[model samples]
Target: MNKIYILLGTNLGDRFQQLNLARKQLETHVGAIIEASSIYETAAWGVEDQPAFLNQVVLVTSELQPLACLNLTQHIEQELGRIRFKKWGERVIDIDLLYFNQEIIDLPSLQIPHPYIAERRFTLEPLVEIAPGYIHPVYKKNNVYLLDKCTDDLPVKKISDDEPYRH
Candidate 1:
């Protein structure tokens, strides 16, 4: 089984509910959930004019390969009403394959070690929470190193402790 790390974000209706729904959907399509980070509320990263987003990171163990995982995630996003209107536009839910078993994937449609991982605090904060010592295959650095090197001045705050991580 491959240890996959996924990031979920939402800024649309019922943000918390959307996150929960995304988690459930991922568990169904991607694989069983192993670990999840607390929800982080963060300012819009690329397009600053939009609403703040709620983000979370999760670790899952899956038997599917990289492209199959990406296909399923995109399918889930569309099923939940995601329209790609802008580069970093607000959406009902966003699912990103952050890492795939310390493997590097750079296909046109999918990019593992999510290219922006080291640049966004929102992604890094929750990642650091659950997998601080996990190394990035491309950078050869751990989550802690990426968090420390992140230059995205945007604020990432943990808004919910009411919920525990997923199993």
Candidate 2:
């Protein structure tokens, strides 16, 4: 099984429910989830005019390859009502593949060890909560170090302290 880190974010139409539904879809299509971070609420990144987002990071073990994982994530997003109206536009669900077993992959369609992981507090905060020691493939830094060095300045506040989901 390949270990993957996935970031979930939603800003529209019952944000929490969107996250729950996305988790269910991921479990069915991607793989079993081994760990998950508590939910965090943050101001919109990139586009600032939209509603705040609820975000979380989940660690999953899957048999799918990188490209296949990316495809499944996009499929889940669409099935959950995502429409690409604009770059960084508001969405009902956004599933980002952050890392695929510490591998560095550079394809025209996907980039692993997500390019923005270090720069976004919303991503880093939840990541640190679950995988502080998981080193980044390119940056060679642990999530906690990345979170400390992050300069995004955007406040990423944990909205829930629930235990990591396991099944």
Candidate 3:
């Protein structure tokens, strides 16, 4: 099985419920989830006028390839009521394929290593919680190191201390 790290966020409708539904869809279509981080609430990036987003990271084991996984995630997003009105626009759910087994990919349809891992505290925080030692193939840095080096000024607040990633 190929190990994949996914970052999930939602800012519209039932945010937490949307995240949970995405998790279920990921397990069904992509692979079984092995680990996830506690949810974090963060101010909107790109477009600052939008509402805050709830974010988390999940580690899964899947047999699907990179593009195939991307296809599945987009399908899940649409099924869950995502509409691309603008770049970084508000949405019901935003699922990002952060890393796929340490591979580096830059395709027109998808980009691995997420292109913004080093700059987004919302992505690095939850990622560090679950996989601090998982090295980035390109940067050759671990998740904890990346989190410490992140310079994104946006606040990423943990929803609660006791909450687990799983529903």
> Where is model 3 poorest over a 10-residue stretch in terms of lDDT?
158-167
Q: What are the per-residue Cα lDDT tens digits for candidate 3 across 1-167?
A: 89999999999999989999999999999999999999999999999899999999999899999999999999999999999999988999999999999899999989998999999999999999899999999999998999899889899999855868553
Query: Per-residue alpha-carbon lDDT of model 1 for 1-167, expressed as tens digits?
Result: 99999999999999998988998998888899999999999999899999999999999999999999999999999999999998999999999999999788778988887999999999999999999999999989999999998889999999877876765
TM-score for each of the candidates: 0.97, 0.97, 0.96
* lDDT sort, best first: 2, 3, 1
Error of model 2, residue 64, in angstroms: 0.3
| Candidate 2 ranges with C-alpha deviation above 4 Å | none
lDDT of 2 by residue, 139-158 (tens): 88899999999899887899
**What local distance difference test score does each model get?**
0.92, 0.93, 0.93
Give candidate 1 misplaced runs (Cα > 4 Å).
none
Candidate 1: the clashing residue pairs are: none
TM-score of 3: 0.96
